[model samples]
Each structure stands twice: as C-alpha cells, then as structure tokens.
Target: MSTPSPTMPPWPAESDHASGWSLVRAAAAAAEAAAAANRPARYALVAATGLLRELAPEEEGGLLAWEPGTGWRCLLPPQDCRQAVADLYLPLCAAHAARPITVAHLGQSLDGFIATGGGDSYYVTGPANILHLHRLRALCDAVVVGAETVLTDNPRLTARLATGPNPLRVVLDPSRRLPATHHVFSDGAASTVRACLAPNAAFTPGAADLVVAERGGRLDLADLVRQLRARGCSRIFIEGGGVTVSAFLQAGLLDRLQVAIASLLIGEGRPALMLPGREPLAHCVRPAARLFRMGEDILYDCDLAASTAAPAAAAPNGQSLQRLF
Candidate 1:
C-alpha cells in the first residue's frame, strides 16, 4: 500500500476518483497523441501526471506513475491503483518511452495449442485476456497479423472492446492471397496496410496501403520493420496465429513476446511457437519474464530485448542458456 504525500494537495471535489479503465483510456489517449507528434509517448504521460493526480486525490491515496528508467510506482498510499492493471500495462508504456518496439502476443492452451486441428479457436483464454488484447491494440500504433489469421478469422483488428482509438491494421500476406473483401481491407475503420512480396493489380486504389516488399524467398522482416518505422509506426504489435510471430522471433525482431496460457488443453493442434529446437535445455532461449493472472489465464510477459542485450546467465547447474538470437 502507498502512503499519502504530506506535501501534496487533495484531489479536487469534482473529480474524486477515477476507475482503472478510465485511466487506461487516458493513457491510450496520451500514447495516440504522442504517436501523432512523433515523440516518445511516455513524455505525454509524464506531462499529464498532474492531471492524472486528480484521479487519485491525496486524501484518498492511490496513484501510479511510470518512468522509462524507474518503471511504475505509487506516489501516494492505500496503493489504490489496481496492481494487475499496472503490471500488465506499465511495461508497454515504458516501451513507448524507451524506443521503437515490436511486440508479439498469442493466447494458447496449457498444452501449447492456439487452436484445434480443425481451426476452432474461439476463446482460448477468458474475457479478461480478450480485453487485454484490445488494450494492446489501443496502445500500439499498428497491429499486425499473418495471412492465415485474416483468412481464418477475418478480424476487424480494432480496439472495439477498449476505450481507445483503433490501431492501424497491417496484414502480412507475402503472396498477396487474402482477398480485398476482408473486413480489414474493406471496412475502412482504420488505415490498413497490406504488406506483400508483389503488388496485386486487383486491389483498387485506397482499398488499403499496398506495400510491396523486396522479393526474397520471403518478405524481409528487418526491411519491413524499417519501412513501418519510416511511416511513424514506432510501436508495433504482432497479434497473430503463431507462424508469423515465430518468424519475427526467429529473425530477432521482437522486443517483447507475451503468451497467455489458458487452463484448458487442446491436446493436439497448432503449436504456439514454431522455432527450431535446441537439443540441450541450456541452448534454449530463456527470456526475462513477469507473470500476470488474468481470470483463468496466466500471461507470461517475456522481455526479449532485455534478455538479448544482457550477458547470458548461468542456468540451474554450471551450464548457461544460449544467448538470444
């Protein structure tokens, strides 16, 4: 619990307390504004701390503040702010302030399947995880998904469940196979980018931004990140169906990877990650992680960038895990 500040004034009578969701919305607004100005989003949050203070009046006591260097902390007591909310989100806020970040997230069963063999993946986690995904979209400048996800789900890729602006939608369809009629390409809810290896003449102008990547055996992931960054999408979210997220991870492009493990089991289906296997446990990628319980789901928020930058640590015995690629 946080203690009340002796010197700070109480919250205004007109705005006594703010709901956690309200704060989430406010943070999203700040991030959106920051992206528009091409500045680190955390600066906006810092500038608005005074305004946020009103949500947690000194008398009532429960305030949360996030800094790039120090991370999240309470300025006043009772620590009324929801810890789960802060734990789940503050890293994202910090990521915005630190540098351009590429994050990938997936929800899977305890057995590691994202869906059944027949492709039925309606609710792997619970409502809370779904809302968390929406919050992820709300906080990012762009949300990416592979062609299979588009063909399978036809998702709108909007932050409809959360109180924030919809993110720019990006579809990773290397072959340009997804039809223009999909909701992401046709709905016009937000600007959409169709990234492919070749331009499809069938797509009409303004249908969506057509980004033709350099022709390799596959789309160049690094070049793709550069192009997206050039377009001012500094915070990218890879919301996916495994293969695409795995590709980014293998290419060492992901800054963070979040996987929500549900209590149920799919027994056998598509795996959550498809990385090459390491014969020894010490050779596996061991990222720094923080865990959060969301209803029935357990989210393992892995810090890939931190793990990759730091020196490899010794495992349980004398052996050390392989350095992240």
Candidate 2:
C-alpha cells in the first residue's frame, strides 16, 4: 500500500493544548506522519504530566490508555482529562495499544432500511456522519465489507477524508463472484484482501491478497477474524452494506457497534440488522449506548460487550420486537 501524505495541519503549541479534540487531531497527524516515514506510531497520555506523549517501544511509565469496553485508565492516578478524552476520541484510540478490536457500523433511514427497493443508496447520512466513518477507517487496521457491498457501493475503503494511514481493504466474497474491476481490488489506493471460498484463477486480484474460509457452504466469520489477527491486523472495522454488518452482529463477534439513523425514510428496501425473532423484551440485546449528533443523523454508539446475551427472546413470532435503537 502507498504511504499517506506527510502534509498535515500544524499542531497547536503544547501550552495551548486545552481541548481534547485538538489533542486527538495532533496525535492522529503524528501517527500518520510516522507511518509515512516508515516508523512505529506510538503515542499516549502521560498521567502525571497530563501531556500527550510519544513514546518509544521500550518506554514504560504512568501512561493513560484505553481498552475496548473498559474505557480509559492509567498506571498511576490520572489527571482530570479522562472525561475530555473519552468524549472526543477514546473509543477510536482503543486500538492503539490493544489487540483484536472489532467494531461494526451501519447507516440506515428512519424506516430501518439501508437501501431502496432497487438498491440505490448514495448519501443516507450527511457529511458529518460520512466524516465519522472516515475517521473510523483512519483509526482501524482493516476495513471489511461483504460481496453485495462491493457489487453495489464499490467503496474505496480509505481514510480519504481523515488524517491517518489508510486501512487494509477487506472484501468478504464467499462465492468468489465479485468482478476484479471493483475499486477496492483495482484502485491500488490501499492494500486489499479478498476472502472467498475458492480462488478464481482467471480473475486477477490486482494488488489484493486471497484468503479462503468455508463451512457447510457458508463463510466462517470467526475464522476470518483469526486470519486477520494473525496478519497483525489487531483492529478491524466492519464497514458495510446491511447484510454484512448484520452477519457480524449476529455472530456476537462485534465489540462495539455504531448505528446511524438518518432522517429520510426508505419504506421498502434492504433492512439493517436482520436478526432472529425474539418475543420477550428481557431476552433482547439491550446495550449501553451513547448518542452523538452528526448533522441530521443521530448515531447510537452501542457497547456490545456491556450488553446482555443476544440469544433472541423465547417468545414465538416476535421478529418485530428485536429492533435495536
């Protein structure tokens, strides 16, 4: 994959670093510059000094860091910036020093549809939500999607709108049906991985790698996650077309999920998060969520780890009761 551009916004002086947003931007820019220069991107918040410090691999001390589900913590007693950090980018930074972090996101209309009857979904959410997605791509190691997403949106899967290293693009085409002319495979903007049941010899996966995983005519989602983790992709982002995101969520593999609800309504189309029917409200997956406003869209950041078991309610024929948010 090509290295990102070195040009980035100038960081405010250390004394002027009062806002959490500014600190996050500075850290993200530094990490991108490190990647561009072929160096390790190591950064953290020093607990005692209350400063965002760049550290060497061997360095150890009172550093504040975040982990999935557990939130941010420090070696020593932390300063008063925890709330500020958490409010801005602590969730994204969870992958910084952690491993096997998998997150999923889906954008749908008020009517619970991702696309129209004919499958035409271009800008469901506004620019702010789009930027949030780009930021997710920027922070993660790999971005994943399913075959239908490749056939429909044909997304680039790059952090083009944000400042960071572009993540590896992963397309899960279990049947090997996607044409290699798709942007993720042919663009060469970022490294791509095609996960399928078998390799089609005739199809040139230009600048892309191939991985195979199947079980009883289905792609093994767990196996795919293991393979990605083995490849040093500790952080994975499931950026999708409805079905793909739904599959991950159903598998109970997602640590966090961000569902963006747009104001528009697509009455009959591809729905998001199609899970099994659950009759009882108690058996439903009720996760702890934080709401964030993104232009006209309202994003529900749900912590899947903190949620109750999602084995579906015991009641019969209660499919409509399983909706989240």
Candidate 3:
C-alpha cells in the first residue's frame, strides 16, 4: 500500500473540515522517524492516532461495512486512517524514555452499535474501521476493557490477522467478579491480568499478573500505571464502555482519543462517554485534537495532557473521577 500523501485535502464536500494534510504527513513521518529508534513499538500512540485522525477519504479507496455479530472482518476503503495508525505505524512509533502506551477511548453508537448505533454490535463499523482497530491491538503492550464490557460484549480482545505476540490482557475491574468460565478468562489469547481493587479476590479460574489497587478501598489509577510500566508495558490500549472510558479520561491516563463519529446518530442507551459532571469542563491542560474523514463518519484525533512538565506538577484530582485527560 502506497503512503497516503499529505499535500492533498482528503475529503471533497466538507468545508466544515478544518485541517490540512500536514497532520497526515506528520503522522507517517513520525512513524518512519521512530522506526529508527528501534524501541518496542515505534511511534507514541499520540503520533499514531494522529495518522488515524488525518486519514482523508481520498487516501483509502472506499470504506467497507460488515454484518453485525461477526468476528472476522476485512476493509476496502479508498484509504483508511485506522489502518495506518494501528497496522503499519503505531508499533514502529513506540518510545521508551517514559515509554509510550497507546490507549484508546472508544464506544459504539448510542443503541450499542459501532457502525450505525441501533441493534448491531458486531457489524456497526465499516470493515476498514474494524481492521484499523485490529492493527492498534497488534502494536499494543496491553488492551484494557472494563469488567462490565467483558460481561456485556464477551469480545476476544486480541490481534488475529498479523503474526506476532498478543498483548497482555488487562481488565479494569475495581470489583472482582469475573467467572473463571468466562470467555476472556478461558480464551488463552494473551496473558490475563485482573486489575482490580479487591484484595486478591477470587476469579473463577484466576489468571496471572494480578494488579491490586487498594487506595483507601478504591482502585488507584496512578498505581495501576506504575505496575503496568514495571511489567514492561510500553504501549497500552483501553477500549471501553462509558464508565471505563470516563475513568481514563478523568484520570488523565489517556494520551490520545481516537473517536469514529458515524454520520447517523442514535439518541438512546449508552452515550459516547460519561464525562464527569463537574460544572467547569475547562482545565488548564485541555486536550488538542484534529479531525479525519472516514467513509460516512469522522475520526476525532486528540492529544491529551502530554506536555513536557505536565505529569510531574499535576496532582490527582481530589475526587479522582472529576478530572480530565
């Protein structure tokens, strides 16, 4: 696949689209530059996700959508930002000073759909989107999903197509309540880790690398990050339901936001994210973002609080769930 050029505007009829091809070119350039670093996964997720955001419809031939409830999928879009971010680029962009972790905050349409939010979970997104996300998994050190998500979706969060090691399985469960018989627990796709608050609580058929975050009887996001890093986790991806996504955003653990906004909107069940109800949504370290054109939906790419002096001076929000990423 030839590299998508950055000199051209990706879409045709949307003057509302406010960005240039520089971002797209920068993403590929970043990936290529980092590949020389020879770190675990090349680019930082921030740069990789940038590629996804800048992906113009022109780059990908077209977009393909599959049936709901299907596992394996393929894409035939004109050019896919998702494919660039996860598949060929992100892995080559991984850095190691404070090694980077690529975590994603994603959710389906309101009615539990990814493609067209209604009654479709499996085939809600176009084939390109599915394949693109799969690439992100391929380059990650860990893929996190909330217990609630596991119980509801029962998805096998491992890379299937590309040949390589599967990322470590990390479940963000403050409560320890997964059954040993559960699909994720028994899948053997990757090393399973239950990041829970409960003290060594029992899992039906327990998995290894149990990370306990008991900060005053609650799960500590900071501690969780520390442990993950120690275990050689340079890039992490968090795919979630509303609550989990909200927590990551609130804790400021997310380095990037890769959102696929479908042309159609659903006004019901679960919203995109359950952001904290704090009256003031304005924080000094607000995030910066860029938008990319996908088939019918738009991909919002954001860079969280990743400035040079950010993490050091920042203090955890008093009510942990009331902060921003």
Winning model by lDDT: 1
Task: Kindly report which residue pairs in candidate 1 clash with one another.
Answer: 2-77, 3-77
Taken over the whole model, the C-alpha lDDT of each candidate is 0.70, 0.69, 0.53
Question: For candidate 3, which ten residues in a row score worst on lDDT?
Answer: 63-72
User: Number of clashing residue pairs in every model?
Assistant: 2, 0, 26
- List the pairs of residues colliding in candidate 2: none
Expressed as tens digits, the lDDT of each residue in 98-145 for candidate 1 is: 367788999999899898887788989888789889888988888999
TM-score of each: 0.77, 0.73, 0.62
Ten contiguous residues minimizing lDDT sum, candidate 1: 6-15
Candidate 3 — what's its lDDT? Answer: 0.53
Q: What is the lDDT of residue 298 in candidate 3?
A: 53
Candidate 2, residue 74: the lDDT equals 37
Candidate 3 lDDT, tens digit per residue, 126-164? 554565466567666778878877776777787775433
- Model 2 lDDT per residue over 126-150, tens place: 8877877887897788999988888
lDDT of 2: 0.69
Error of 1 at 180 (Å): 1.5
